[model samples]
Target: MNDSRFTPVDPVDLTARLVRCPSVTPVEGGALTLLTELLEPAGFECTRVDRNGTPNLFARWGRKGANRTFGFNGHTDVVPVGDAAAWTHDPFGGEIAEGYLWGRGATDMKSGVAAFAAAAVDFVRATPPDGAVVLTITGDEEGPSKDGTIALLDWMRTKGEAMSVCLVGEPTCPDRMGEMMKIGRRGSMSVTFQAQGVQGHSAYPHRARNPLHALVRLLDRLASEPLDHGTDHFDASTLAITTIDTGNSATNVIPARAMARVNIRFNDAHSSASIAQSLRDEADRVTAETGVTFELQVDVSGESFLTPPGDFVRLVTGAVTAETGVEPVLSTSGGTSDARFVKDHCPVVEFGLVGRTMHQVDERVSVDQIRQLKSIYSRILADYFA
Candidate 1:
């Protein structure tokens, strides 16, 4: 790991402090407050971009609208801790044991935020760059995602703030540190199908139109077909049956209505429009055959995007390799993340600690990895401004 001429802010301590906030999704929980307090003293201009009750912070270490601004994006909100009794450590305790920090967001991202924040603060103090360093930390990433980064982006446009390029500090590596990074992400969308038919007694099969049958057939058709083969930087798309329910408890009667939800993770080969149209086609075919009326509701979270190997990508790759002694593979194999939103504003990639235990009962991160990530981020900021 690279050592800086300056003593960086203790990222492990910052991470521990943040983990104790207990900021669940969409809840401020003093996480944003803590960050603002830390950043402002370092000469970073901090603004609270709260919208629709969602909390977000925008901090910049240089002038507004700087020609060359490097941005860091991350979230402090964490998923709910399930079955507190199952935990060996306090979910919000931020305790360090076994060379790991124990907490809810220790892996999912509090450490990442701590690492970048420490690097940014120290870099500006040690050797201030000619350009700007921006940080966009939100409190709604694990929630509906309506007013988090999207809100900050909207506000930035209105106020003439911009970042030349951005890095999202989500957990990107699967098994080891510096083994993988995300240059692109698969698109994610969900479609819910509602079917209507006549309810009738089970004894007379001819009298009842079973909507459940139509839904089952349609789901099978959608799942059976392959979306596409692997692309140059993306894997084949996938469709999964998330839920199916009629809510009908009657033993002798067929339900009149059935509802089902299917989630799809698609590659660059298809857009949400194409996938929705295919679902409509399948529904129409099933309706024609079974006489069951169908209604569809679709939600497109993000579209597949790639930042093609360019200077920005190369910069991050070089710093990572220099720090960790390993060349990370450019991958696009994870679920949806806030990078999906930031891509619309600027080129964004994701890199962070290994995410092997995020969202589990005892979510935690290795203490040394947290320090190593700080070194990598510190190097990135130094190189980006050089």
Candidate 2:
């Protein structure tokens, strides 16, 4: 049963409660339910935005058609624990020890969800802002993400719900609590190439073509050349060949086909179409030279995006400096987050606790940082409405 008392919000307690739920990706595990129970009594209209069996929560306090809305987006789902026995503390224990909250999702990022939730609840209840405060929480962020934030955004568009500005409560700081904030993210794409050739005995010199040689040549051309130098707010694009396989069993037989896969993290210098075209061109050139036929398949996850250094960024930076005394360095150097989906709707930036232990065993967060994060979020709310 949820304790529905009208007391002040405590982020650490909220974080512990959330971490104990064991809501790994694609699992409800009562995390969303608990959030609804907590927010409903605090005078927020709560809705379950579940799509294709994935759980998402949307809550708002204040007038429905209010002219201004400040949004906070985050995920409650944590990645799975690898080798549960190796943990010093139970992955779902949510135990507080040695000045830290120990458990999975402690830093990435049930604590972040708790901090923002506690701040939003306390701020709306204590000061009662004239505008609306919106929270978009999802359970599919660590999974395929097909039915998480995207579904919420689709529902919001159909229902005419909108925000003037949005902040994603993702773990952005690399080490120190206030050292960095993500203003953008690099685009991610993966491609697989298959080279087809004739199979024959290895002893026959000119009878059979070895597709592995052609595959190696293709990968060498792609990897040996850099995609680009670093962009203004992003690092240089990187392409890594993740896999090369032929699956040939016999020692004396040349395989008929060989395949190679590459994953690319690109900056604003290119788009999915442009990169795909580049790969196709490289494959065509290799095929023309070697007489090896090729087929390529590509999947683009998200395009690179930036909100720029403007009022929203300055406001967040000033709040962080006020609370933590560290002026945050604006960066775009991390993996993708749900912020990629929200960027299309409005300007979005990411900030949260240090992420040194995000997906590792014995994942945890400093208890003090949770309180500091709450204070910073509260200040952002105050300034955004002012």
Candidate 3:
């Protein structure tokens, strides 16, 4: 290790330090301060943004006024540690037993934050490159994401801080570190459909219109067929009906209305608007066929995008293959992240440690994984700005 401060954060101690801060979503819990302490002294100009009680930081280094800026993005807030008694170890203990640093954010990603910070320290110390580097750290990703990465990105854009490329430190790999990378993300959209019918006694079936029957048919039309065969860099799009309700208790009477909520995870083949139009078309067809009145509401969560294969991607790929001898498969799967918002600014991808234990009881990571991740990120920095 050329830089003393760059050695992989003793995964044990780093995990312990971070978990001690009860940084439940929408709370600071001193995690930002801990991060600032580690970064400020290492020549980073850290700016803490407190927007509506949510904590976000924008830390920058290297030469100012540089056109090429490499960004490392991550979230500090973690999901609530549920049912503490169900865990074999303390949920917030950040314990280092059985060769794992166990804690709430250990994998989902305080570990990634620490490792990336350490990598930045190492990169600057070894060779302060000509281009700039920035860290977009937010504390509200685990909850309602209103005040987190999205807000921070708006501020950065207002300041004219454009990035050449960005790497989000999300846990993208499944079982082994460096085994996978997310080159793109599938888009997400939600729909709420309602069917209305005249309510009447079950005994008088001829006079009553049952909305449930109409709703069931509409749902079948939406799910009976696949959205697509799958995109080149993404999986096949899927439409899942998350919930359905009538809120009626009387079995002898027909309900007046039925409601259903469906979520769609789509590939690069479609946009939110296109998907919304498809929903409208489907609902209309179903309504016409059933002779029932209906209403459809669509919430376009995110439009799909991909970071084309480029210099930045190859650099990270080479680094990972060199360090672990694992050729990471670039993929586009999984749930949405802050990356969805960042995509509008610049090409972005996600790569980090194995995510097998994120958001689960006894969340943990091995010390060795942190060390290799630091090395991988360091190499990426060196290649991008060298």
Q: Which candidate gets the maximum TM-score versus the true structure?
A: 2
Query: What is the TM-score of each predicted model, taking all chains together?
Result: 0.96, 0.97, 0.96
Candidate 2 regions with alpha-carbon error over 4 angstroms: 1-6
- Which of the two candidates, 1 or 2, achieves a greater TM-score against the reference? 2
Give the TM-score comparing model 1 with the true structure, all chains together: 0.96
Residue 46 Cα positional deviation in candidate 3, in Å, after optimal superposition: 1.1
Per-residue C-alpha lDDT of model 3 across residues 162-208, encoded as one tens digit per residue: 67788999898888878999888899989998899889999997798
For all candidates, the clash counts are 0, 0, 0
Candidate 1 lDDT over 1-386, as tens digits, reads 23365566999999999999989998899999999998998889999999999999999999997889999999999999999889899999999999999999999899999999999998888888899999999999999999999999999999999999999999988888899999999999999999999999999979999998888988888889888887999989999999999999989999999999999999999999999998898899999999998999999999999988999999999999999898999999989999999999999999998999999999999999999999999999989999
Q: Which pairs of residues collide in candidate 3?
A: none
Please list all clashing residue pairs in model 1, or write none if there are none: none
Ranking by TM-score: 2, 1, 3
In the predicted model 2, the residue pairs found to clash are none
Q: Compared to the true structure, candidate 2 yields what TM-score?
A: 0.97
What's the CA error at residue 364 for candidate 1, in Å? 1.3
